[model samples]
Target: MHAGSWHNRYPGESRIVLDLTSLISLYDTALAPSLVLVCAGLERCDHRVLGISSEDISRLMRKLTEVVSRPDWVGSGIDQKTLIHVIVDRYVDRLELMQHLLNFTSSDSQELLQRAKLAQAQLRVMLTPYLLHSTVVPSSDTSGVDAPHWASLMFKNCATMHTSVMINQILLMTSSEHL
Candidate 1:
């Protein structure tokens, strides 16, 4: 089933069982990577450097968090713990990258810095529940799978993407300085 179709199904209705693998693949290949790329490209410049407005990115980010936090994934055979872990891990990486950028940002970039800070604060508020709850009752479908290992791998990929973006940005800065 297409990922868009999942949104059309009503909650608590009898529907085809969604495969957890497809769901994870959709997130891994699409959602998480897009979010990471956008977050990585966010800069302290006056112009919209990524060709997308901050409001649009903010809306997408909010929708992503909302969808993943819903219990619907549980009924669809997804282990909520693992799903949340993957998303939260990516979010933490994004937050860290934003903080790293903010620390080096100049005073002239106050607007961008404030926006990044706000986004970080909002994400933290949204993640509070997942962070506070420590109980893990493994689902039968995912019991054998190692969620932490998966999360670690996902985090590493995001980190790698962020690193590449940062390196490119640095190179651009240096090259432009010489021009």
Candidate 2:
């Protein structure tokens, strides 16, 4: 009988009820200090919520290269080792995609750019929770245009790689209009 698992014993009692006043109070009590820390970091220009440095990236890549792509690992049994490997592999894939996005370029084809734009928008829905508006605010805001949607996708070590192509397209469109 675990203390937290009391809910498991009485399933109906597990429901959480909250009114607006309680919710606001909870936010003030629990989240306010966290927000202050975020503000302090912003003041110090310390972006990246999880502080993902290049060493982390390199380590992840090296470990992933050593483990996940191995043929023997693919057919391995579903044990603790295999599960950890699978999770690491996924994280590595995300990091690779993030790297690709950080160096993203657009094709000359408008149709392809359009397709990429559509895909980028779709990707944003899933990415919003991971993104921060403050991180996006300092990016290039050309000719009064707001920061491109892709700029907002930087999170920890992963970003919206899908949006880089569209960002190039946006830049081209804005630049060409002045020419």
Candidate 3:
């Protein structure tokens, strides 16, 4: 029920959700998740975009669809798919979505462009091998892999705090050896 706080807190202020969860989950990725925290930080900032590439947008949509569909029951993480569905239905700002292609000259446009580029490059880096190898599980341990770096990927705010906590529970779950 506490869903509308950000709107009143930042009245008349435009908002954007960087959606880096889709970007971060694009591969088995082996990396521990850090992108969520970083993106959440960025989304809290005021910003705008000038031109977001279609390829990048397409990548997000694809990653969104894929991750949204494949809930990782084996690991400790949120039902990424469910959270994404909820966020898409409720919080997404259409004006921000529509103006994604503005021409960049100011700070806003540059930040948008930067976010897009980061996602685009991230997809290429993380997914290329997966596609080439045609498997979900990677060949080896990737514990040292760094999480993606971006802004605006938080799926839980005060309203969905419980869901966020559950997700962390899932991620921290592991083999009996860790216990």
Compute each candidate's TM-score over C-alphas: 0.27, 0.19, 0.21
Query: For model 1, where is the 10-residue window of minimal lDDT?
Result: 22-31
What's model 3's lDDT at 125? Answer: 53
lDDT of candidates 1 onward, in order: 0.55, 0.48, 0.46
Q: Enumerate residue pairs that collide in model 2.
A: none
RMSD of 3: 17.8
- lDDT per residue for candidate 2 within 33-61, as digits (tens), equals 34444445264345333543455455556
Candidate 2, which ten residues in sequence have the lowest lDDT sum? 18-27
Q: Tell me, what's the RMSD of every candidate?
A: 21.1, 23.2, 17.8
lDDT of 1 by residue, 1-179 (tens): 47667765333233554434334321232333444444454553332225445655566677667667766443644444444445565577766865665565455677776777777776786555344233354576875777786566556665455446456767999999999
lDDT for 54 (candidate 2): 52
Best by TM-score: 1
TM-score for candidate 2: 0.19
lDDT of 3 by residue, 7-118 (tens): 5442224354333354554222233233333344354343222243455556667765777787543543544555655545443553244345343446677687786775
Off by over 4 Å in 3: 1-45, 71-179
Q: Which order, best to worst by TM-score?
A: 1, 3, 2
Error of 3 at 118 (Å): 29
Instruction: Report the alpha-carbon TM-score of model 1 versus the true structure.
Output: 0.27
